[model samples]
Target: MTFEASLAETLRTFQALSSLRPAIDRAGDLVLATLARGGKLLICGNGGSAAEAQHFSTELVGRYQKNRRALPAIALNSDGSLLSCIGNDYGYDDVFARQIAGLARPGDLVVVLTSSGNSANILAALAEAKKLGLDTIAFLGRGGGKAKGLATCELIMPSESGAACQEAHLFLIHHLCERIDAAYAT
Candidate 1:
């Protein structure tokens, strides 16, 4: 695609995201509240979404456009040893779910990113989060697939392209980080 075409696609995706303001705000509020209650965030995803998950966790645990105390956030995809073990023992689909069972607390927030919103691991993790009484949020695309109904708050990117969905997910991640920093900065 040409640069101009890419830019146009991005703009259209952003425009579609504008309608999800309420869901985005709710996600930010959930994150802030979880932190206020001394609860950590658990994040998981696949491929590019996995990278985005780690990026989000790093922003919270380090700093996000500001100097501040670290927040408790973990990217479940960060642990290669644990993931390999879980995948080996419980099947590949149980990686995130297994980790969630072991690490998540009641008040913590579980965030899963998936362009297809139909990854078995993500869906399993969301189900596990619910079983463990953790609130779940999904940054999803492709009409949210089956994972939409599972998330407490679903930010379904209004795009059919995986690239567009992933791009929008990163935008939402940055927005959430900004909101969290602003909330604590006060």
Candidate 2:
């Protein structure tokens, strides 16, 4: 696709996100509630989605737009050594799940992002989060694939285009960060 075509697709996807407001609000509320109770967020993804996970963590732990108190958030895929260790020792699919098992507490929220909701590691992480009795938010695409209905709240992108889906996820991430900044603004 040409750059213009891609841009048009992205705009269309973003426009459709208005339909997800209630679900997006629920996702934001879960984040706020967890942080309000001194709980952290455990975020994970793969490839570009993994980068967005770290972006989400940094926005929370550092700052989005406000000079507010720092909130706790971990990008489970940010630690290369830990991910490699788990992948080599357990399996690639166990990387995020192992971290959730080892690090998550009762009040923490698990956030997983996936352009295609069929990755085994993401599935494992969601299952682990559920097993631990923790609430979760899943940012998904491609009709939510296998990971649909697996999360406490899901913002399934309204587009089937992979790039458009990811862009939509980032938009929601920024929107959620705005909500966080509002809640924690100094």
- Scored by TM-score, the top model is 2
CA lDDT, candidate 1, residue 142? 87
Candidates in order, TM-scores: namely 0.96, 0.98
lDDT of 1 by residue, 95-125 (tens): 9999999888779999999999889999999
lDDT for each candidate structure? 0.93, 0.95
What is the Cα-based lDDT of residue 97 in candidate 2? 97
lDDT of 2 by residue, 96-169 (tens): 99999999999999999998999999999999999999999999998999999999999999888988998899
Off by over 4 Å in 1: none
- For candidate 1, the TM-score is 0.96
